[model samples]
Target: MAVFFDAIGQGGSDGHPFYDSQRTEHKHVANGGDIAVLAGISYSVTDLALGPWIIWDSTLGDLTRKVSYGGVDMQPIGVIQWGGTAPGAVDAWTEVFALAGVPAGEAQVVAAVWGGMNSQRALRCQTVSYTGVHSIGTPIIASGVGNSAVTATATATAAGRIVGVFGTRSGMSGYNGSQRFLSNDGVGLLMGDAPGTGSPQGQTVTRQNDGPWAGLVVPLQAADTVATCEPLIVEPTISSRVHRAPRTGGLRRKVFKVPADFQ
Candidate 1:
């Protein structure tokens, strides 16, 4: 009869020999897709104040997408709530709201929006009240500083959020303007800043690689680099160091050398 037994090659001679192996660990940001919230109402801002939409990214992985700027049209992926149309106006302001299921992290709240909209502007602001414990570098905190590095009238230290704060008007005066803004606390971290107590604001965005919108938010801008329409993020990945690796194969498949005639 032919023998077909597998060999359990040994490396040590103390009556027992073994090999060690392990699995690798990896980290990635949760993808924030199809999240819901309200954005804008059907009324008008009597004082012509800025509006902000607050939303969160699903994953905390590296932010990958196009570099969008202000005044550009953006489609939100969340539910929105507007107060309907104004009493006598055909097109009026709308109230927006959203909830980014992602918990607070070390990264700031990076966001982008359509610039030069007829009657919309994005601004970063502080959260006036929240159950979240945000680090000073979080987006909400970063949105409180003015471009001049001075404190704006609406700060976001204890419980505040940011708002879109840049834009100009050549015709409609109170309508056409910039629709996004970025802010950083004194410590240095860009964050998303929305408006009011519960407005719908977006944190960051990514796009499909093979689509037309690809150029808008792809190649993931490094968090340390400048801000574009794409969501700015620092992705996480698996890392390792060799303690003692087998040179011939992977961890799951290994072999051992035996002394001649030792068995």
Candidate 2:
């Protein structure tokens, strides 16, 4: 459960391919050797081989930063690059925090989340028939999806679940390439696809048939237009009793519930 990133001498790797427009796969340089190597996630860390990834924490209404650790009882909130703050909450910071392991808090124990921004993100889909060949720029949608997957047959813009498009060529499931990502989402969707034990509950994405997720799926081929890193404008948690979508800017960190929270 060590959240992996690219290793040295690599750009994009398997398992974890999530990144934002603010930074590319090369941002993870090991040394200033002018050689852009990937510092993919490992149980390893160093001044030269690390990241500036940021994340959020409300484990107890107190925000804490983490590094190089994974959680068994929590799903890391998305990297909080563009800082944000929930109403009556603290403002986010510019420093990036990796999705590391965290401690529990009173009732506010950490849960799973990854605050999304206008950053590129890929989703994993089970093997399904395609409508012809899905190429780059082919818009994706979902139909009353119970989880994060495209349905049989084909879809269009504003139709069903509006997941992102194909970063690479594809006619079936798992179509991401080296620089592309769908595979990472695959692992996340299944939570490492732990066999026999079954995928963790609530790990499945739910769409209300025609219900649209009001957020942005940063495309793999978008431009970096950010002038400077700024604080994220998080929507206020109006009622602590009713936890809603936590937004960064245009993206919402998909929420996951820890079994302990319910049981």
Candidate 3:
């Protein structure tokens, strides 16, 4: 098994314009094996006025084939006739989905955020590859109050599994123009190994807040892998400034490989 993490793009700032409308490209490195699963998230403004949104689109090698997840609304605020209105400070929303049989080759994942008049948006994505039969667990959702951190936990039924987590703000009170907006939300993943004599049960795989996306890869031994994993939410420390990651200049790619015999 191999895990790849990339911060596709960030909006509401110079050079990164996801507020009005924008599309960012991320390169996927091929492992010469089948793609077991893929997941992503978008961090956008949580104000009810603009109405946050996020979506993903991908193209196989040579742009011959493509797949996409329809746009997702991240706003958590809602109104009812009897209730009048619900929580008004919601800021962000996240989701994870599975992919069909994607061949072993280079590919590209594109993330887009739009429909908001002057809101900020950011995107992050992950890709996993394995050789044997594997299953993708249902996506878990978690939330927090008056804070940026959030967490979700789930049990893994099979070994050699890759877990993902995405995080964003909710119910932001103030609204600013695209240039001054806060778009620094982040995502992270953690893995817990199966019970053992002396080894610790949980370990932090990867935690990132400076960028748009973060991922963690767990290589499970068919005989000794863990049965549960946790995905944690990381919120931006600085709310006033928009953090800019080092530009990729072009597509960015990363790869991790797990030994075949071990699993």
lDDT of 1 by residue, 1-263 (tens): 11011111110100001111111111212222221111211111111222223221111121111111122222332111121121221111111222332332222222222212133222221111122212112212111111122111222332323332211110111211122212221111111233322333333322111101000000010111236588778766655443434676554535455433311
Candidate 3 local distance difference test against the native: 0.32
lDDT of each: 0.20, 0.21, 0.32
Model 3 segments beyond 4 Å from truth?
1-19, 32-34, 46-89, 130-133, 146-149, 158-162, 169-263
> Model 2 compared with the native: what TM-score?
0.17
Ranking by TM-score: 3, 1, 2
Candidate 3, 189-217: lDDT as tens digits: 22122211122122222222222222122
lDDT ranking from best to worst?
A: 3, 2, 1
TM-score of each: 0.18, 0.17, 0.43
Best model number under TM-score? 3
- 63-87 per-residue lDDT for model 2 (tens digits): 3322221222222222221112322
Count clashing residue pairs in model 3: 8
Reference-based TM-score, model 1? 0.18
Model 2 gets an lDDT of 0.21
